[model samples]
Target: MARWEEIENEAPEFAARVRSLFEAGTNKTIATLRKDGSPRISAIEAQFEDGEITFGMMQDSLKLRDLRRDPRLAMHCPTLEPPKENPESGPGDAKLAGLAVEVPAPPDTPHVGAGFFRVDIREVALTYVGTPADHLVIESWHTETGYRRKTRA
Candidate 1:
């Protein structure tokens, strides 16, 4: 697992593209594990600060509870509909999977009494239509395997 900064250092262009996708929208989706080991999907807003990707939840929120119980999580950037006439023009979609490590809030933090966490990324991926719009393309980076790209019909 590595911090967001590590990804930037290792794969600058890929990291930039992924970060742009995340920043393009205000709300993102996160999946956490429930007590029964089921997946819980929730809306969230994350920030890139101090070389980390962090998010905060309201105090005592179920999502916070879920994170406390199980730190594993996956996050998806806001999805954009690809242009039917020119699918290659779309910005595409990005996703990341990682472990959420709890962090201390700063003294003047806005989240006063909330839970905060930083992602220790396991893998990151971006999916989109290929240039000719004839196939789907997936670009991914993993902690152990590094970066790779795949295309499918």
Candidate 2:
């Protein structure tokens, strides 16, 4: 598991693109595990600051409960439709999978008494339509494999 800063250090350009996608909108999607081992999806707002991806949930919220029970989660950045005339011009969508490590909230924080966590990234990926828009392009980085790219027609 690695922090966001490590990815920036090792893959600067890729990290920048991923960050851009995440910052393109205020709402992101997050998937967590329910108590019964089912998947739960929630809308969340994430912050990229101090070299960490941080998020907070309302006190005793279901998502917060899910995180407390099972920290493993996947987050998807807000996405936009690719241009029909030039799909390659789109910035693409980003996703990350990781364990959420609980952290102490700072003084006078906006989310007072809420649950706070920082991601320990296991994988990060960007998916986009390649030139000609005939195939999908996936660029990914993993803790074990580092960086790789794949395409699907």
Candidate 3:
């Protein structure tokens, strides 16, 4: 229900951590629903700008068709192994679940007939291990609930 921008404005600190995870790597993973109602996972690059998350796909891409049909999607930020010497420095991981509202192509667009969509985030979360005690922390934001935190010692 909320766009990335709204979350940022409402919960700046939590949003920063989630956005950092997304910015930590260029390649992210997206999950889409296949025509047969099964799940398909694909590599994608997304842009978080102008208070929205957007991505484009080549013409006739399965993911594109899937989004067109189902719209629902889940995306995850790329993960890195914890540093050998400093576990505290681990950047953690982030995930977004949302609906992809396809953007209408502009007549003069350069990518020919590529597909585009703006993410309508339903849930956003970041998971990390806290310092010292090393408890697992999961911080999440939702359109209806705002923000919540959970820790497992």
Q: Evaluated with TM-score, which candidate comes out highest?
A: 1
Candidate 3 overall lDDT versus native: 0.90
Each prediction's total of clashing residue pairs, residues at least 3 apart in sequence or on different chains, is: 0, 0, 0
Better of 1 and 3 by lDDT: 1
lDDT of each: 0.93, 0.93, 0.90
Mark the regions of model 1 whose C-alpha exceeds 4 Å error after superposition: 110-112
lDDT, model 2: 0.93
Rank list by TM-score: 1, 2, 3
RMSD of 1: 1.0
RMSD values, in order shown: 1.0, 1.2, 1.5
Model 1 alpha-carbon miss at residue 114, Å: 0.8
- lDDT of candidate 1 over 53-120, digit per residue (tens): 99989988999999999999999999888888999999999999999999898678777679989999
Tell me the spans in candidate 3 whose CA falls farther than 4 Å from its real position. 106-108
Q: TM-score of every model?
A: 0.96, 0.95, 0.93
Worst 10 residues of 3 by lDDT: 127-136
Residue 116's lDDT in candidate 1: 86
| lDDT tens readout by residue for model 2, 67-123 | 999999999999787777888888899999999999998787887669999999999
